[model samples]
Target: MSFANCGLPYHIGGDIKDRSKLLLQTPESFLARFNVDVRVMNEVVSINRADKTVTIKNLIDGSKYTESYDFLLLSPGAAPFIPAIAGIDNPLTHSLRNIPDMDRIIQTIQTNKPKHATVVGGGFIGLEMMEHSTNLV
Candidate 1:
């Protein structure tokens, strides 16, 4: 139901020496702990409040299906906001919103080995990125 250790990339490097420590819960652990079906890599495309149903698409094969529910809780998190700046779309610039984004940022830092990195926001996520980036230096 959730990416358990989203905050992990901030603590671990690209090599990921100890995956067990980083992984907060596995599918088996989650099932045993909460007795809930965990669906991973599925995207909720639409919700029908009238019928109390949600339409979800399998991210792997692009196949979609619908499921009825008595109640639905939507928790679509926010994406990193990139301002309309020149060269913001450049390959060198990166933002950390998900695990992939964090991986790419780490890869860029390791490969390029930049002396300085500029984090735009002073928010929690921004501060985390700044801290991780500082560790690389």
Candidate 2:
């Protein structure tokens, strides 16, 4: 999902009402605009520099294919850090990183309707989640 990651909290806080606004571009739109084939659910398992080919796995079908490319760019983003604390694996504990995470948080908030929330990290995402969560509660 190519979206404005920074605006996740605002969206959850009801500041950004339209969820479509958070999406920067769709794969089809990106391909149409830039003529670049953006594969979303494909994972590059391995790269062969000698052959200039990459072995990609289809996440949906579990099928593997090799594609040759002139240039390969890697931009694996960060993962939410879960501290090694007791009850850290609880379902209520959420980390805001991607759209799915944000959705889960919203669903949890709506379903559980907890009165209080404990935000862990003090980073941009964390602070935004805290602010939005407060507004939500």
Candidate 3:
């Protein structure tokens, strides 16, 4: 997620049109290069702070596992934050959170061809999310 949205800012800067270079680090590269061990598609269902342990499961597979950590970093830059609309979910709305959400937004736009999208929150993250939809940016 950190390096995935790299190309969107360029839209604001008017640098490039497409954003293929933004998604440079795959799960393997993020893990191997940074030594961060990025467990792709994994959900942290529970966190035991006292024990310094984290419980996770892969979204693709139902396998469960636990990891011990000396310290934890919580930097989920975005989440599916809806504004309590009457029928927001009915019209296929979304927010940027992870790699899967990016894919979903891309696929939805490709299949539905959405036009005149109304992005609610106006901030850094909202800008990033909206800028990314421009030709799969």
Candidate 4:
């Protein structure tokens, strides 16, 4: 999960040659290598402790399903801690999350050519983003 944060910062810095390299295992490989089911583009919406089932929504389509598991590992990974602000949803603000956020920030930097950028957060990812953006300068 920590490596996920590591992935985006490097992409932001243009350190990683290819975006696919960030993945340790492809969805198919993860399923094949381990006897685990890898469901790509599935959004886990809720977990029912009483029923011992996890509700998942397919991100691609609007289909929803449930999975019953004897044991479950909640490893969604840490998301960029974006605090709620009045205008935070405005077009300009962006936080480095998954590939899309990294891509959007990079495109914004290249297209807009902003002189100064402010990255808020004192966490590891924030520090990494600072180091990455400095190289871009």
Candidate 5:
């Protein structure tokens, strides 16, 4: 279930050459291998412990339905800590968190071809971003 390869951009030299190599498993493969139901683009809205049911909402369509579950495990992934800074929302500024974030960063780097990139944080992700930016330059 781990889709976020946070360090992938750095490993692949900013541009992902082959996406199939990064894909750990497809939904069909996951289902066949683990025998677990996989529902994408769905959000868990609420859980009713009294009735042992949970409400799930479809992200694409504004539809909600309830399903009974004997046990539930929640894994809310971490998001990038975007500080409130000037021009942080600008199209030139970018942050890498997931695959899409990395893609956007790569696209911006290729399209804009900036002379320099200023990474805010000094954490692992930030360092990776710095490395990628340097390589791009």
Candidate 6:
């Protein structure tokens, strides 16, 4: 399932309340409604523009294959800017990006029960996190 990624921070801070509400679409729904074959766990490793083909990697089974396409749409999403700093690799340090990252952050808050938290970025999402983190205190 693909989620409304912008709502991830709100979901973390209890503003979203319902986790399922974040899910925006499913592969089956896309296939049924739009006839789009949404391959969830497949990654396009390489694109051959000359031949109009793409090399796909199955993330789950570690298999690789190529598929020819009339038109290719590249929709790789953004990643957080993790600065190179001391102790940045520590398990406590987390970046909010995808569903797994959000899950880890939530699990850390619940299981570790830390008294304090640090938000790195000062963008809109960062401010939302800071406000929500304070509310959780």
Worst 10 residues of 1 by lDDT: 12-21
Regions of model 2 farther than 4 Å from truth = none
How accurate locally, in lDDT, is each candidate?
A: 0.73, 0.88, 0.68, 0.80, 0.76, 0.87
Largest lDDT belongs to which candidate? 2
- Give candidate 3's error at residue 137 in angstroms: 17
lDDT of predicted model 6: 0.87
lDDT (10s digit) by residue, model 6, range 10-38:
88888999988988889999899999888
Worst 10-residue lDDT window, candidate 4:
1-10
lDDT of 3 at 102: 56
Per model, state how many residue pairs clash. 0, 0, 0, 0, 0, 0
What is every candidate's alpha-carbon RMSD to the true fold? 2.8, 1.4, 4.7, 2.9, 2.0, 1.6
Question: Candidate 3: misplaced stretches above 4 Å?
Answer: 1-3, 6-19, 90-119, 124-137
Write down the TM-score of every candidate. Answer: 0.81, 0.92, 0.58, 0.77, 0.87, 0.89
Evaluation by lDDT, superior candidate among 2 and 4? 2
For lDDT, candidate 5 versus 6, the one ahead is 6
Ordered by TM-score, highest first, the candidates read: 2, 6, 5, 1, 4, 3
- Best by TM-score, which number? 2
Q: After TM-score superposition, what is the CA distance of residue 58 in candidate 6 from its true location, in Å?
A: 1.7
Clashes of 4: 0
Arrange candidates, best lDDT first. 2, 6, 4, 5, 1, 3
Better by lDDT, candidate 6 or 3: 6
lDDT of 1: 0.73
lDDT of 5 by residue, 10-33 (tens): 543646566555657667888999
| lDDT by residue (tens digit), candidate 4, 65-102 | 99998998887668656688788887778987777787
TM-score result, candidate 5: 0.87
